[model samples]
Target: MAPGQKLYPRATVRKVVKAHSGCNVSKNVDVMIFLDYMLFMQDLMKEATIEAKQGGERGVTARSINKVTKKTLSKFKG
Candidate 1:
């Protein structure tokens, strides 16, 4: 947890991992890795959204990434 960062409840974290893993409960290491990846992706999405709103060419890249992320997240859906 970082300064100014929101702390998610342990149950919420476990639920997210289970949903992504398609299992009752994911391994601790796997959960940590997934959470890290999700954080990176969220940051990317935020940056892209901002750029797109500003009419930047990078908006195209953002859209592409969003599509890919959506597909990947679908596979992990609980």
Candidate 2:
């Protein structure tokens, strides 16, 4: 991913949040949403890398991700 590139557009995120909560979200909320999920995904990938290394793999593979997913989700449960 490139710097400053976003997976989800802020306007779309705001719209989805509003649709779910029936309340408008501010710009800050949009930023926070992006930051929070970005951090979460970064953490998830880090864990997957570790899992792959422990399993003698060269990269993060699907098996590594699947193995660590439950443990990772348990950490970030909200």
Candidate 3:
């Protein structure tokens, strides 16, 4: 595992459950699912942050504009 990559221990798992307002029967299981989802969201946030910074340096146009234009052009090809 890397710096922030580690499996949830039993205690952290419980906390995640509580954070999500879990019920008794499937709380732990739900927590595990939530942990995985949170981890995925964290990775996406990190990537977006980096991309935004790089885009900021580029200037003149935003990524959404570029992305939409690319999609529009690709659609015309079909």
| Each model's lDDT | 0.64, 0.87, 0.56
Which candidate's TM-score is highest? 2
Q: Which RMSD does model 2 reach against the true structure? A: 3.9
lDDT of 1 at 6: 79
> What CA RMSD would candidate 1 show?
6.7
Cα error, residue 62 of model 3, in Å, equals: 10
Report the lDDT tens digits of candidate 1 across residue range 31-74: 66668678767765765566566665545474655645665565
Candidate 3 global TM-score: 0.38
For 1-78, candidate 3 gives per-residue lDDT tens digits of 789887758666666666776655454675656776676555544555566666674432356344444444443342
Tens-digit per-residue lDDT, 35-76, candidate 2: 888988998999999999999998999999999889988888
Candidate 2 regions with alpha-carbon error over 4 angstroms: 1-12, 22-24
Q: What is the TM-score of each candidate against the true structure?
A: 0.38, 0.69, 0.38
Residue 32, candidate 1: C-alpha displacement in angstroms? 0.5
Candidate 1 residue pairs in backbone clash:
none
Q: Between prediction 2 and prediction 3, which has the larger lDDT? A: 2
- For candidate 3, the lDDT comes to 0.56
Cα shift from native, residue 32, model 2 (Å): 0.9
